[model samples]
Target: MKLAAQRLIAVALAVGLVSCTDDPPPAPKPTGLNAGTGCPEFAGSGRQIEFGGEIDAELGGVVLGAGSTGVVLAHMAGGDVCQWLPYGQQLADRGYRVLAFDFAGSGVSRGHGVPLGRQVEAAAGALRADGASRIVLAGGSMGGAAVLAAAPTLSPAPVAVVALSPPTGYQDADAAAAAPKITVPVLYGAGELETSFAESARQMYAATPSTTQRQLVLVPTSAHGVNLLNPETGSVELRDRVTQFLDSYAPPA
Candidate 1:
């Protein structure tokens, strides 16, 4: 009995020591854009794509509108590529090539643990290779920060950009630093209720050296990121507004 009791205590001590050692936290899953109201999906538009793992995707019409422009949309942290379908369809209707893809760790593209910028790079490269003469980059929240982060790295560079409710910084992406380097027209949008988010937009706008045009929109909703783009959020005119912005600057050609 004595020997058994001593062995049990030793076993307990070993288990306790193992439990105390910290294991690294699990990888984060994308959220927010995963559900809730988002722009609708096109009935029969876009297609599947494969470039390092896989990406949910769509491609716009072949003929260019005016600038021969193509647009690439990156989704928010938790959401996948489907949410952008409605807007992408609109762009397609307007004669612009539109490409939307999942960001590796999210949606159907999940589990690659790829960094966001690499995903953007891959998407943009695919778009360019597929005949996009010029490109525009757009995103919301984490996705927004991602495009902004990718701005400087684009070889031919995007003609314009739209970042809605982007963070001031994320990981290697510092908007404050990046904004100055981007020499293109930009449309920055934010909601009034989220002070930090609105402030971040303002800071990014201020940092961007826009000689031609740069507009700041303060949407009247608590919505952050792509949620601001949703009509149900009460910012009904955003769709037209974005279309107009793109028309005036990066319109298809």
Candidate 2:
């Protein structure tokens, strides 16, 4: 009886040990998640131009029009528009060698905003220096206004002007008065909710000469600068509209 009891005790101890061994290991404490690089790097000429301390960095701008040509992409707002990889790529796909860079004090570019006219001249100079004889000036908000201010001064004048939510009357009265002088086919797009800017866009369209193929597009449910970055807010439609307008006015090679 004593021996049997001892065996039973030993078996109990063995069972307990086995049960403890079978227990799963405690879960490791979670480390914090890492930050993500927003978009992919742009691929292109890899060339950069330094104009008045602003570095107009080039990316994937080598792809030109139907004949292996390229277009100068001037991004007027702030930040490295290069980060808007999708926007640049979409334009690239449409036969544009996009020259997307920042204004001085904005992106990788080094300088700050000079006089509005000077800003336009500088941008035009950048395009001309890049060997684009027939240029298409596309701008957004401040950029749009800059392009408009710069258009008349371009040596040969830009082939077309596409302004997205451009601010009118921001500069002097002369600048506002000069908006009508843009004779090229002008395409203006704005969000329906952007009251002041939408009105400004309408004013610009109305002011332009009747000879100019002026178009005003009201993007439904889109707000100022909202669709510029967010992919979900019918940005594709906006891009298509701009591209179509550009196609109608692309300079002859």
Candidate 3:
């Protein structure tokens, strides 16, 4: 009996030790755009210009309407080529002259050293150069954060913004604090499975003081950044939601 009691105690202790071992915390959730594969084909006409290098390739934007309103699609951290191509094209088809380009280091854009703010500036410049008077800044993941960070710097100011799976404070609090400054109509979306970023999205929506027209749509059974890529499946729903938001705030002519 004594030996059996000792053996049972040892087993319990072993089980306790194993339970307390503490596996490494799960890998930090990805904050930036993750590169997928393939190149996005551009269908519109402008002038495909190289801004920096292979990464910063600026394809000529398609002019949708005679008006000055435009939408700039910002790429996530990795590159926008394969992932954002379909969505960009969809926006183009919707009659919004869209400018979709890679960041300096990530895509066809030149220079890998450009920071987030500079990328937003580049998008704004593309819009202004193309005669876009009212701009709608749209981005995914880190690109979403970039637009928020650059909001204050845009001279004419963006009329609205659409952020998909935007990270709240992965890097710092500045991005979160910038939320209040975004007074324009803002549309925010996230994957229901993306519990990691759910709180962040909520915080951003809650912090924004502008109640003009703000929305948060939690997509079910989708992964972070996947909805935009598979629009036919779930991405289409996201696009429609965004389009409706923009339609409600049609930019000034």
RMSD of each: 16.2, 14.4, 21.5
lDDT of 1 by residue, 1-253 (tens): 9999999999999998888786667898744223112323452445444454343332221111222588888777777666566666667777887777766556545434455665676677777766688888888888888888888777777888889889977766666678888777778888888889899999988888767377788876778877777777736665567778998988777
Model 2 lDDT tens row, 13-89: 99999999999999987332111122324433234444432323222222222322334444545434553335656
lDDT scores of the candidates, listed in order: 0.71, 0.59, 0.64
What TM-score number comes out for model 1? 0.73
- RMSD of candidate 1 to the true fold? 16.2
Model 3, range 67-174, lDDT digits (tens) per residue? 467777666666554456566555666666666665655654445445675566666776677777778887778777877776656777888888778887434325
Q: Candidates' TM-scores?
A: 0.73, 0.68, 0.71
lDDT score, residue 33, model 1? 28
List the candidates ranked by lDDT, beginning with the highest: 1, 3, 2
| Residue 146 in model 2: lDDT | 69
**Residue 165: error of model 2 in Å?**
0.6
* C-alpha positional error of residue 30 in candidate 3 after TM-score superposition, expressed in Å: 36
**Residue clash pairs of candidate 2:** 44-60, 54-110, 55-109, 64-69, 64-70, 65-69, 73-99, 104-111
Give the top-scoring candidate (TM-score). Answer: 1
Compare the candidates by lDDT and give the number of the best one: 1
